[model samples]
Target: MTTEIIDHEEVHAFTIRKEIEIAAPIEIAFEAILDELGADAQMPDGKSLSMKIEPWPGGRWFRDLGNNAGHLWGHVQVIKPPTLLEITGPMPMSYPAVNHVQYRLKANGNETFLTFAHRAMGLIQPEHRDGMPEGWTQWINQIRERAEQKARG
Candidate 1:
């Protein structure tokens, strides 16, 4: 048996940032985010992912597969309700990588502005790196719809 090594000159790292305006109160928008990212999370194709988030410092963000099995997405690093949430861990990646995710909400009268960022580095595959931007956009759009629907009712 022989050992083989691969050398890379460029580091694999990326940051995705998105800002969305929601036609709802900050509190409502924040709740929408929590709901969307948690049990209500869906793929871009609208299928449930069965995700769960514990919204506090040191809590977990993961997917529940049942039968005492699950995928650990991340841990909550900081949480300030209706304002900010930060998590750090490897999300949905089975390879060597570190990820950080943040959600921030700001209120402007009856409108809410949400800023989201997901940063990761190390051995990221092309599919994940390429798909994240579009996935995040769809998720954000879902959150907006949920919030606006709540506001309308």
Candidate 2:
């Protein structure tokens, strides 16, 4: 339920990592995380975003934020299903550069630990770092909520 921005040695890249203890088992948590990759997943803000995912290495991943915003597009470079997913693409803000995102999951008894790391070299301008923390915080919270709900069921 907390988010912290870690300061790395690279000035051009920023990393945000969050961990949550969900009430669900590892399998349920894993499935919930994977479901979030779909276009119809419900966002934390109660908004439904359309997602298109090929779910394989070198496959494409996209989200429809609606309103003709085009698609937040990226390529899935790694997919270890129920464990890891790596994507390289532009942020929702349509930044002209591509960043890398890695999601790692581990099971601890009845709880599942999830880690998300985003690395954007030179794409996250100095001024943008301040806002990046909050943006990632929200995303992580959403993931935690969804996984917990699925586990409860």
Candidate 3:
């Protein structure tokens, strides 16, 4: 499971990579990321945010808003179950901006080493770009917590 995110380094002006080691198996970690939240999925504050992933190359990872109006977060560019997953064309960015996200996992003893990277190019919105790393850190943390908890169950 080897891959890298390429970019320059001025914060939002380049690619961002965040890594976390979780106390869970790679499979658990991977599943935690790919599992679809049912239609009623919502943010912690109750805002609608449906999420699902098909977990296969060329599969879709998206948020399904009601009435079929949903955001195409990205397409699974590559998937080597429990090890690597790459997605391209994510949203929260429109035309003139494109994003690529990758999640790499490696089993270590009984846990998993997870690496997440997001690369964006084009006219990135200042606010969006500014919050990306932090946003992704929070997102990855939440998923890590879930994976660890599931492992203990």
2 or 3, greater by TM-score: 3
Candidate 3 residues 1-153, lDDT tens each? 999996663433468988899999989988887752324344656575787767778888788777988888788899898898888884667656678888899999889999988888876778887877776776787778888999999
Give residue 20's error in model 2 in angstroms: 2.4
Candidate 1 per-residue lDDT, tens place, 42-135, comes to 9877789999999889999999999989999999998999899899999999888999989999999999999999999989998999999998
TM-scores, all models, native as reference: 0.93, 0.76, 0.83
86-140, model 2: which lDDT tens digit per residue? Answer: 9888755455566888888888888888888877766456566777778677766
True-structure lDDT of candidate 1: 0.93
The global Cα lDDT (0 to 1) of model 2 is: 0.73
Off by over 4 Å in 2: 1-11, 40-45, 65-69, 125-128
How big is the RMSD of model 1?
A: 1.6
Candidates in descending lDDT order = 1, 3, 2
Best by TM-score: 1
Best of the two (1, 3) by TM-score: 1
